[model samples]
Target: MFTSREGVTLDSIAAPLRRWLLNPVLTVPAALVLSGFATATPNTDSIKFLVPVCALVLAGVLLSLNDYLDKQFANNWVSDNTWNWDEEIVVVTGGSVGIGASICDQLLARNSRTRIVVIDYAPLGWQPKQEETRLSYYQCDLSDSNALRSTCERIRSEVGHPTVLFNNAGLVRGVSIMDGSYGDIEATVRTNLIAPMLLAKEFLPEMVKRDHGHILHTGSLSCVTPPALIADYAATKAGLLALHKALQLELKNIHNAPRVRLTIGIFSFIRTALISGHTNVPNFLLPLLHVDTVGEAMVSAVYSGYGSTIYLPGFNRVASTLRGGPEWFFRILREATANFRINFRGRHEVDSQTGKILKA
Candidate 1:
């Protein structure tokens, strides 16, 4: 007879394994190419393929080691065994729709004992039935500093100080640097980068005092290799990468709060309203991810009770080492994809004054 643990389902195990095996992350291709060489006649010409195979193996091992070290180093090599879901207050920004909403749902499903406080300017997409008091919604524009502050204060007085913060809310103008207005640039920066910093300022002190909390930022591949036409959005994402790394350092050195875990999710394009009409041509190496899949990963990272640098689909982790490679190669690769957003339409717009999404 077959059996399983409380949360260990077959899909959970098989799905990740399948994704890893099929990913173009050196291992699968290396195996196939190496096998072809081994089966070929013992000639000098056939042996040339070994060069690429060796490089692939080396790259694969290095990336794997980097991934392991990142997680271990962020957690200070300490395993957290003191997590209590009942007392934790989870905060999700942009929780009204798409991936954010999915995260809110999964968090509730993961543990019925925890409370969730959603901060977004839009109305909650799902209705909570009576007696389901664990979820609360706060309508506030993250781009507006004053509004964000007031809303956080309300959350503190109404629910409690958030022990877990998800900086998932973001906006994109989808225009070239010269084509956008000053307001568009400001709104994008404020929403994408500034808001997360301010939110950290509000809650991080409390987390440090208690020495127990988690902060997860939703980052983008633009941080790794920014494409054309989305300069403002990409710049903010790069800033986010810097902010996350800096916060990790400060949390360890200044605050001395190793238990205050910090995690960042780095992902590519997704099937969300934010990029509804995006004209990105899909390729095997770069696939458009599903919102629920990414949301599940983010929620799982939080439950792990450790800081992590999450790269969804696993294959995109190579982006971490891309800049360190040859400049000519990077330039050629970037130039080839320069027109990625040439046909993409702007799916959303933000109102600078009211801090609400005028068009989405």
Candidate 2:
């Protein structure tokens, strides 16, 4: 609380102490210590002391799982490749907008030599930040496999093999199966699920040969708890999660390319154009995350060679495990918020911009 030059002040102590008390991680350990004292006291109920201690330990282990996984990946990947932002060529999918753009901003600013290539159909000419020559843009709709391959080949030829790949491109119509178009369905599945696999197919082998690389897949809360209305979106996300994990196993066990790090990001509702005009589950429980913050985290992990399945606003990690819990919990959450699907309002895609049920 006190600077060495200033010595301790009452005000300085209070603020630091208050923050320590408010921090759940620190507070839990403090409570456990107090519980230990209580259990030792005569006539004090042992259950009261034991209850919170058990909870603290359980939560600690669950959270440590991410750390353990990261440590394991680091041992394999970092030992071979190591983290060098300057030498690494980073390629981000869908970098023309939203979190992808944010990630590009961070990486470009992070190191002058780290080249960034953005693959997206959208024009990045509108982006003010991309004025710097450090970032390159390739116009290719990932849904078109031929266009995707051609673009990748061009990137490989021009930029060298990208050592880091951010599979962040994603889309959702926010409509039910009946309301969705065949074109839209194909686009959604291709963009969200198939494209990521394709990108991996294109880039992963190069990483394996070099014995160095990182792949961060942008998963969703939908992977754990599929919601109503956006069934296709949720399904694609679930498939992404499964396939991403399978890719990790195949890389490490089959190819013996332990140097390739895989990270999956399961984010809740993010404040981005993709989810614009949409509502989230009660903000009190799950707040809308800023794109910049999420992007920074993603960039930091890859740039620093950290690896793990990260849950943004990390409490969602515990929430995700609820799937294995009782049915009543699911029913209550579904009934309480109605899956955050209320904003859809039963509109079908009658046009490119607006949705309204047709005369039929």
Model 1 Cα lDDT, one tens digit per residue, 117-190 = 98887788885433555888898878889999999899899998889999998888777878767777888898
Clashing pairs in 1: none
- Measured by lDDT, the strongest candidate is 1
Determine which window of 10 residues in candidate 1 has minimal summed lDDT.
Answer: 1-10
Question: For every model shown, what is its TM-score relative to the native structure?
Answer: 0.80, 0.77
Worst 10 residues of 2 by lDDT: 351-360
Error of 2 at 296 (Å): 1.1
Candidate 2 per-residue C-alpha lDDT over 1-360 given as tens digits, one digit per residue, 9 for 90 to 100: 432112333333544644554445775776677677776784677556666656655665565565667677644534544667767889998788788988888887777567889897767733534444466789887877888999999999998899899999877776678877675567778888999999999998999998788899888887776677778888899998898778777887798887788888898777766665544444444666778867987987786565677776555677677778899996675454453643432212233322221210
Question: What is the TM-score of candidate 1?
Answer: 0.80
